[model samples]
Target: MKGKRVALLALFAAVLAAVAIEPAAAQSGADSTTEKLIWDLNNQLMYIAVPITVLVEAILFYTVWKFKNNESPLPTRENRRLEITWTVATAVILLFVGVASYQVLAEPYVTATGADAGVDTVAEDEEILDVQVTAQKYNWQFNYPEQGVTNANTLVLPTDRPVRLNVTSTDWLHAFHVPGMGLKTDAFPGQSNYLLTKPTDTGEYQLYCAEYCGVGHSQMLGTVEVRSQDEFQSWLAENGDSGGDTASGNETAGNETGALSP
Candidate 1:
């Protein structure tokens, strides 16, 4: 009896340890809504599944130890109630997860746009900022069509406004992912992809080419600077409306400071 109790305690401890393990680190979101939804989904799924996993493992271990080395194994009778209980429980858990996933997918702020956002879209509303993204071998370029300014390596945007990035690749396939902003979109040659996000907080966030491309894969890193509306406008005025040459040029060799997106 003492040995059985010890075995049960060890099994329970093992289950608890498994449940306590933390998940992979996720990037902090730029907006409150996106951040809340992500954390809520993570917490809800863990709450629903952890207990079930613990219970199932505990029962299995207990049964294994209880029956081990028995001189005559007793005939087991099938229990209809046990079967029905597990089946219903599993269905209920899955149903809950499916509903939650749908809710996350339906959120407009996180979804990608299908069509290219134009000046008309921006003129209809000043709140929308359109930044065009072009991805190359190991670099990224950000162009403001409305402002008529182009930047290489660094992307600058205004906080408290919805920004749409129309992304395309010049060569090779790449994935544009900014973990901090909870944005990821694939960049294909000759095809454009769109990503939408609202920057609530003002700061520099890390951007990377999530897809493996070439020799400079690890060096493909960039920064996104989110500034206030007035500051952003001032920056546009300072940089002027001319779409200048990108960082790849020999003239701008020393100034090349950022990465590609999309």
Candidate 2:
């Protein structure tokens, strides 16, 4: 009877541990290609670092315990083979990390095109949805020049479709960062930056200003709504302004044309 109670308690403890650990392991991600690559690199580096950290700590503790309170200690000779082995091992590990990082960066999904450089890789295709982003003191304005729509603090996107954003600031510097989409670009005054992404899931994601601008920086918040292609078209039709080109048209034209002014 006593043995059975102890076994039950141990099983209960194991169940509790698993429950506690599962949520931490299942943290949400950006649900995009760029974020997946970054997370893969992070997990791989942790796998490589954890064992080395444990081994070094074990060696340090053992050395301290073995030589505790020793008045006289004999001189220890260092082995040349050990030194060479560690050096070579470290070099090989670094080489592996560098190669892996380079491969991820080389993918076509991650790219940066200057303001006046060639057409944006993502935007070059005819099927792309272009949204011009304007950043100010504490707000973000998203303009769909093609659809003739201007939305403030809310960016709407169509799922499963490629999106290209032209980002620039009017007053101060800001960073347009959407963690769920794994897209971030700087909003510089008089200069344009670009970011491309495709949201696979249909949900609302949070957007934030990654750079600190002023006192209202903490309140610089926005939302990105991902909808189906049909729903997106319907939204554009309903909310779009017909007469005025509220969204400045800068694509395929001069760079200074589409500055989102007040």
Candidate 3:
């Protein structure tokens, strides 16, 4: 019994250690302001959660070990002081969580308020690019209204500039999610949702449809290419007016069926 108990405790400790380390290992290097904010919030919560989890589990295990062999267990007695202390502590923890989450969500780049607000929350001096995102069964269409450039399965953005994505769907519900940049917004038919992000790194990030739309949901994937301003402008000049003259005119005409290169 002693050996078994020791083994059980050791196993529990190992599990807790794995749980504590997994988040750090799984966290990707943040490449945008939104991502950084989310990561910071996660770390903040973990700082509170990890210690509480360990302490609670430790108390549970100790109580079980201490009382396991009690032949005549004493009647349970309620301690009002202990109960009140825990209640207050829990309230404080919840308050911290609520305030921290609100701070992130209230940011303009995090969650845009109002319908068709566009990039109104962005700083006056900052440059903003508008991209129209249309979602279909299993693919994505990106249209740069100002540049008159349309592309399928690939969203090209410039680094260090705010990009306002006006997202909507042509058919069913879908969600535009870019995990690396921490951008996600729902795409509803006949209604536009907006997301704002400024890419800090020049790289390719995976774009996924977070909401399951149909059987092809798993295949609904795209790429977000972040480039330097000069490179993006050159590419835009080359691709603009090649086809897809208007944002709504060529929804199904230009490369809409094209799949992202693996």
For TM-score, the strongest prediction is 3
* Poorly placed runs, candidate 3 (over 4 Å): 1-27, 114-121, 243-262
For residues 1-262, what per-residue lDDT tens digits would candidate 3 score against the true structure? 9657755765677567758766784666678778877887887787677767766776677779888999899987999999999999999999999999999888767887644443566678987888999998778889888887888778989998888889999888999999889999899999988877788889999999999887667878889999999999998988887735443444443334323322
Using lDDT, give the best candidate's number. 3
**lDDT-based ranking:** 3, 1, 2
Better of 1 and 3 by TM-score: 3
- Write one digit per residue (lDDT tens) for candidate 2, span 1-262: 8546545655565556556544553574546656666676765665566556555655666567768988798897988999999999999989988988887666545554643322444445537678889987677788888888887777999987777788999987999998887788789998888766666778888999999877667777889999998999998998786413432332212222223223
Model 3, residue 208: displacement in angstroms? 1.8
lDDT, model 3: 0.80
Model 3: lowest-lDDT 10 consecutive positions: 253-262
Residue 216 of model 1: what lDDT?
Answer: 67
lDDT of 2 at 197: 62
Q: Would you list the clashing residue pairs of candidate 2?
A: none
Candidate 1 lands at a TM-score of 0.76
Q: What are the RMSD figures for all models against the true structure? A: 5.7, 8.6, 5.7
Better of 1 and 2 by lDDT: 1
